[model samples]
Target: MPNPSSAVSRRTLVTAIGATAAAIATAPAAHAAAPSTTAAPSTPAPAAPGTQAARTVTVPATRARSAAGRAAAGVRTDFPIQYVGVSWDGPRRGGAIRLHHEETGPGSWQPIATGCAGGPDVAGTAAKAAPVSAALVPAGGAVGYDLRLPDGATNLRSTALDTTTGPARTTTLSPTTPVTFCGVEYLSRAAWGADESKRFKNGVENSPAKYYPLQTLTVHHTDTPNADPDPAATVRAIYEYHAITNDWGDIGYHFLIDEAGRIYEGRWSGDDGIPGHDANGNAVTAFHTAGFNSGNLGVALLGTLVNQEPTAKARRSLALVLALAARTHGLDPQAHVTFVNPVNGVTKPVDLISGHRDWLATDCPGGIMYGTLPALRAEVAAL
Candidate 1:
């Protein structure tokens, strides 16, 4: 077992995985290291360093992108950053928020291909005094960032995450590669640096884990940067944003696949070794879709797929997981099925394997990835 608290690097999680379908409840604890501590900054710093613990920094909320799409106003951090997400004190809006990042050194700026729009403005979560951010944009190994917020997008702020800190994950990381539990390259929460303690506050769970009978398997793209350098840290940053900032108590998806095709376990499904289901195989309700959470299994690819195609490794893990879920849940991936909110009893027709945009008014999972949903469905069905 790798330490639960030690950091996980993209290198450790990268492995060649062509998996077979198996129920998560019966899966193995494929990898882990004992918990290790790193003093992460809770606030922003003024200059760049060789490395730093993973953390988020607030940046100027509004700026205009140049006609050439150059990053307008920006901020510098003391650590190498991996991803950036935009948030505002207002409702989510339309308009491209182009971004640029300085890789390690000043003047080496590059544009992030996927200009972000954040996530769907969900019900109930809209009234929080907290800023509502859309999707994330890639900023690989960047030490500085710049952005363009949509016009009239008030109180704009950027959530820039420096996930490329920490030492290179060594052999201490269990398996040091993907582990096959039946058929997928699964990374347990322990495989990443998830602070299980974050799931609780004042010794009580923020929201008790809830499960319902499985219905549909929905695929999503996190709208983060691609070619990630430290996916495990990225996962941790997302966990922080979702569990702490978003008050969701956990990351929203059931699973997360890195570009290397490793399927990171998401949403703290249970103690029975299952990633997203109860013993009876009921799906755990997560925060991905607003009105249709219950019974829908949400799996997010860990990057902005709309701008670039997911690597072949990511695509394989995605198909394997979807195939595994469909097999475990008795779903027909290629057919149109009725999706009923197990909590609200509201029903809608959906493909057996659908995209985030299919159920919400957002460009999630990206255009490039979304277009492959049909092919993904067939692949899942074939599996």
Candidate 2:
């Protein structure tokens, strides 16, 4: 069956119905990037050649039992690591995975969190390939992990990630100035060292970029450790996890905001200068929301917000981005709207600025951050 999202023209869709989009491509692939103006999007382009993987290490779980008579595994990594996740070969099931960290082998252990699982919405089943459910979590730049796996699990695989290599890669402890466009300032893909070649495998893109009219703007948290050493590198690791590890061929969120209030571009919208919008001010469909990805825009906070709150800088940036999106898309940040999915016609009642958990049965965008929606909405509305 032909995809209704890709079959329609951007201009025609906007005129017929004012719907925004989250990306869901149907074709093999094309290149992407948007223009500086709120209106400019050339067709997608073919990406550059592939670069060999480096930094990401796949560690096999060594099954063990602790004194508590619970199933667990111990991974003593020798390299500098930042993120961790576990995967199984079979279908995803209900269970919990707890991770602790140590800076050295057999040193000391501290608890991190259980099932910090995050990424593109698993509920949306329209992608060309299935994404391996890696209950991904931030490793706090630790050298080892204490793992507690779910009972009766099979084909277990654990992977550790480290994007900061050495002196060669910039370990930017400070935020850089973001490029301004669409009434906001943000880091472009090139600014953050995005390897666009990853969009393709051999020669064909996994899923081409898709565009739709503006709908709603959503918020989320990366579930990564706060006070990030190199937020840019964290963004790259997430791109790798989502594009390659999850097999989505792109990052999930439309924008990622660091603790310092620097906003990095997420998902390849186009090369036309606009971040998430097409030449006509239409939005690019992203992987943030599952069945309702077509017109919802997703912006994520960089660190874990479960127990803590976002820095004032990050909150300011979030409000700025949301306000601009709401103004541009003709949305009331404080009002409720029933969103209709453009492709599948799924209907969802949502706030103009909602938490990630609003769309699916997941604790995303964190609990504390989700609770401040009313204030966030008022701030955006005021802006």
TM-score of every candidate relative to the true structure: 0.68, 0.70
Let me know the TM-score candidate 2 reaches against the reference structure. Answer: 0.70
Best by lDDT: 2
Per-residue accuracy of model 1 over 70-160 as CA lDDT, tens digit each:
3224656655555565454444554343334453344443433322222212344321223344445555656666555555656554555
Off by over 4 Å in 1: 1-81, 89-133, 138-160, 166-180
For residue 212, what is the lDDT in candidate 2? 75
Best by TM-score: 2
Misplaced by over 4 Å in model 2 are 1-78, 88-103, 107-133, 140-148, 154-157, 166-177
Q: lDDT values of the candidates?
A: 0.60, 0.62
